[model samples]
Target: MGKEFIEIFEKWADTYDSSLTKDIEYKEVFRGYDQILDSVANKAFGEVVEFGPGTGNLTVKLLELGLSVTGIEPSPAMRKLADEKLKGKAVVKDGDFLSFTVEKKPDVFVSTYAFHHLTDKEKAEAITLYSNLLSSSGKIVFADTMFRSEEEYEKAKAAASQSGFHNLAADLAREYYSTIPKLKGMLEENGFTATFTRLNEFVWIMEGIKLQ
Candidate 1:
């Protein structure tokens, strides 16, 4: 879904952590960053498959929690950085949302800040695929930018433009950021009970527990 932005991620790899610290526009987006990572790691259990682990931030947390993590990162540069940071504690390989291989059945599928690469249809497809792959009581925990409604989405874009966050505004317009209702429907259709919690102004933690 977001593979189109691979080049950008590759370029951003080295500066990604710096940007999180220095970028005022993203301050709200990543507010309570550690908390967000901890929340996701806490919800996960057993063998975990983490998609789009940009720089292994959440991967570290998962490992610290004694959860085995298999990270799927599409960007080579990002993978290298993650590997360096991880120090062989976890394996981060080349893969994306729709395609990947794992050694074991994952108890939880987790992602952070990267799922917005998929359009709504693709998001539904991914959810369906995960539902089919996971066993009963498996979980999906993702933290990403999602709005509650189309109107809110529009307002966010407008506000960004008004605030002179041109790049952010453009990103809001260009990305496949989704609405909560749409995501909830997709999870339910795929046989999961869905719930969402707002982690910040721009991010939400979505949890879907597969039915028994």
Candidate 2:
């Protein structure tokens, strides 16, 4: 689903980590990055299939938590960096949200900062695919940008633009970021009990546990 942004990711592979720490515009978006990764790793168990494990930041945390992780990423450049970082600790594969292969069924599907790459419809389809692939009680833990309402989203975009953060503003306008209500409804409709926690002004943690 997020394959459309592969070129951007490829170009970003080298400076991606630095951007998280030094990019003024993205500071708010990645405010609690380490904490968010920790929280996601803490909630995951058993085998994990991680979507968009760019540079293997979350993948490293998952391994540190004693969990086996398979990282699926679409950008070869990003995957290369992740492989170098992981050093063969976890399998980083080439895949995206809607297409991937796992040798065994995963107990958890985890992602961070990447889900917004998919449009709402693609997001729903991805969730449905995960729901069908997972066993009862399996989980999806994702931390990404989501607004509480469309009004807030528009306001944020406007504020960014007014603040001279045209890149950030453009990103908000270009991405398929969804509303909390829409995401929650999608999870529920797919038979998952969903919970959300606000991590920052621009990021939220969404946990969905399959009920059946």
Candidate 3:
């Protein structure tokens, strides 16, 4: 699944950002991701780690905040685009988040609209790894999905179908809707105090602080 998804992302690298804001729902989600990143990212000096930066949207924002970031991405093409998008700014590393390792623990870790790509067990283990990879008192800004009240989940499904935006990424969006709570609990279980905030619709945002 990882390799297959990586190939898919590689194909979408150049056009993904343009597609994201084509639909009103996705446009709103992109705007929310930008706003959240602009708001909470505070470790302005030390290196920061970002997972699956599709096209450097969030990476650019972090750079604007006066932080140098190392972006971990599985797709080579996406890496190329990120490098182009953030040229002379961010260091783009071609790697998957699940097993990707770094020698230096980052001062802050963040992922946006990307965490839902992980499987249940992977998400759990990721939080544990992230806790270890973060320096003491490090923070994480997790902006992605959340547990949908069954009714809300169904409503999102119905609405997506109605919007005529079916082909971009339908199945993945559904999978994403269910992954949030498990991820949130995973962060807390790993000893990072977490707080989840609903940004707009299904895309939720969270903040985690690694205790001293």
What are the root-mean-square deviations of the candidates from the true structure over C-alphas?
0.7, 0.7, 2.6
Report, for every candidate in turn, its global Cα lDDT versus the true structure: 0.93, 0.94, 0.72
**Residue ranges of candidate 3 with Cα displaced over 4 Å:** 31-33, 40-45, 162-164, 172-176
Q: At residue 107, give the lDDT of candidate 1.
A: 89
Which is the winner by lDDT between candidate 1 and candidate 3? 1
Number of the top-ranking candidate, with lDDT as the measure:
2
Least lDDT summed over 10 consecutive residues: which range in candidate 3? 171-180
Residue 29 of model 3 has an lDDT of 57
Candidate 2: tens digits of C-alpha lDDT, residues 1-212: 47778889988999999999899999899998999999899999999999999999999999998998999999999899999999999999998999999998889999999999998999999999999998669999999999999999999999999999988999999989999999999999999999999999999999999996
Q: Model 1 segments beyond 4 Å from truth?
A: none
Q: What global local distance difference test value does model 3 have?
A: 0.72
Worst 10 residues of 2 by lDDT: 1-10
lDDT of 1 by residue, 98-165 (tens): 99999999889999999999988889999999998986799999999999999999999999999988
